[model samples]
Target: MKRIDVTRNWQGSRLDRFVRAHIPGTPFGVIQILLRKGLIYLNGERASGAARVKGGDVVSIDIAESDEASPPPATKPKRGPGKRAVKLPAAGAAAAARKKLRPAAVIGRDIRVLHEDDDVLVLDKPAGVVVQPGNRAERGSLLDSLEEYRRRSARTRPRGGAAAADAAPETIEEPPFPYTPVHRLDRDTSGTLVVAKTRPAARALARAFARRAVHKIYLAVVEGVPAEEE
Candidate 1:
């Protein structure tokens, strides 16, 4: 039995949907066949098509040796500033610099900050709030708020150091300003979210999740009653 640990990023989706997303290039009919053969298990129990998953559930599926061929690696985004203008402080004066470097305005009308620290920010995203901006016609998003957070964070740091000064003007670099997401909650599901302020922290959190070191609990309302244990 091949095992794969699920992450918080996979929460709120159906078991079938999650399987399809992770096992790329496999046909839907193949997945259905695996399910019928008792090859897929959710938390050590048989899973059905309709089973809804939470963040920490374990999903295991058996794959034949013919299917073990490796997929191509995903490409990383380009480095450098990408020609975008960095909002400069006014007049090159200290006071003017401080005033000009203020954080961007918060968007996403429904989002609220739950907790904040020098290394992270936690927000209670409302059910309908979108985390990132969409098409040109669409209005308000979480990315706007994150940009504001980044700007504010950048303004507070000293103007020295190789990584800090050499970092892309448009965005912060690793260690100090890595701009990473530790985990993500669904846009429609409102709950706690953890954002990493630095690259090392982000990597650490990712490893923790992969190792199943993080634990999560959820409250759900079901429509049926429990059967007695015989």
Candidate 2:
């Protein structure tokens, strides 16, 4: 638990951004999770990640020191010296990779489907599920599940309904899926996630987010009361 007072010069910044500036070595994802859980406060009230802070505001951040721990090591077997290298079939290799990459198939696991349509899908993701693949080997993520869903849906759609004469030939692509997430949510913070199903939709959604047209709100619990409001 730590208490920090915001100075006049630190006003007009997002709460997460402000905290990142002051705390060195703190991951932004961790801060986001804290903000979502109400561990961060502004003027004695729970603060959202998007909450605006003015100068001279007293912000209290209640972070549990134990929750921040290094990730476990990889579980793959180590290669031994002098082992004959055998080339696997390219197609087989690709399939294996996909299987390994298939994000956790844990349906109904800490996620709530908020809205679904042809162009987009919105979900309320719970804490601890990685939104996307990372450098590590952790499987099962929101993107992976969405990619699977997309494949199933594409299979069911009627084909040859409207083909563009000059359209480029379609090709098989890898999954992390074709859909683009308009924005990201922290692994430990549960919140709404918007995913675009098509390239055009993806671009439009991304632009909307970039322009701040999308509205987001986070709820958190704080440690103490504030002396004054901003």
Candidate 3:
């Protein structure tokens, strides 16, 4: 059994959907079965799939890791010389395609923080790093880097002695989902990205975006000249 804390990123998400996002390659039917068996728990209590999860909630998933791994795709020989065609399962194929979009491993320092506060974190996202996980298991995203930075900050934070005692309690407390992208930039697009640190902030930002209250301006550079009315 594994326990996953509900972060602001997944706040207000349905239990089943939350589990689905966290546990990839697992069939939906299996999740239902687990729920029926009371193998899944929310805050140490049996929960339904339709229940909503909030930040700071603890979810316990009692599922075997083997069940999470999908069988390998089948392969067949093609008509061409020394060529073969592989048949991938629908879910597995999609997951594989998503995984292919990820770049090489990235460290926390790669992401630049433009602005940070209790409610939001703005970053200068670099080209080639994804905004979030393409798949549940895939990493090397801006979100991952933010988490890494949070972890590093926690490790370096003052501990013990009078200096530590004088530190703010909130600083020493475990952060709940340090970053949740309210908007997304393409993996190849390097630009300013806004992330929410609290669920209320996330909701407000989402509403603002939905209402088109936020304005965005983009700049592009081209090296070659275009043809003259060709």
Q: How would the candidate models be sorted by TM-score, starting from the highest?
A: 2, 3, 1
Q: Per-prediction TM-score, please?
A: 0.41, 0.45, 0.43
- Which ranking of candidates, highest lDDT first? 3, 2, 1
Tens digits of per-residue lDDT, candidate 3, 1-230, equal: 88999999888888988998898866665677678778889999999999999999999987674344433343443447753332212323323433553552334747666555556666667888888777889977777787877788669867697776778475455446666788989998998777777666777678657644465769888788878542
Q: Which ten residues in a row have the lowest lDDT in candidate 3?
A: 85-94
Candidate 3, residue 67: how far the Cα is off, in Å: 57
Q: For residues 1-230, write the lDDT of model 2, one tens digit per residue.
A: 67778887877788999988888766666677678777888999998888888877888877564255322332543548854322212223323433554352333465655555566666667888888878557668777777777777779887654455347577676653376677888888887677777665676677556544454567987778866563
Model 1 residue runs over 4 Å out of place are: 1-110, 133-139, 156-178, 221-230
Rate residue 103 of model 1 by lDDT. 53
Find the 10 residues in a row with the least total lDDT in model 1. 83-92
- Kindly report which residue stretches of model 2 are placed more than 4 angstroms away from their true locations once superposed: 1-110, 158-177, 223-230
Winner on lDDT (1 vs 3) = 3
CA RMSD of each candidate after superposition: 14.3, 17.5, 24.1
Clashing residue pairs found in predicted model 3: none
Go through the candidates in order and give each one's C-alpha lDDT.
0.61, 0.67, 0.70
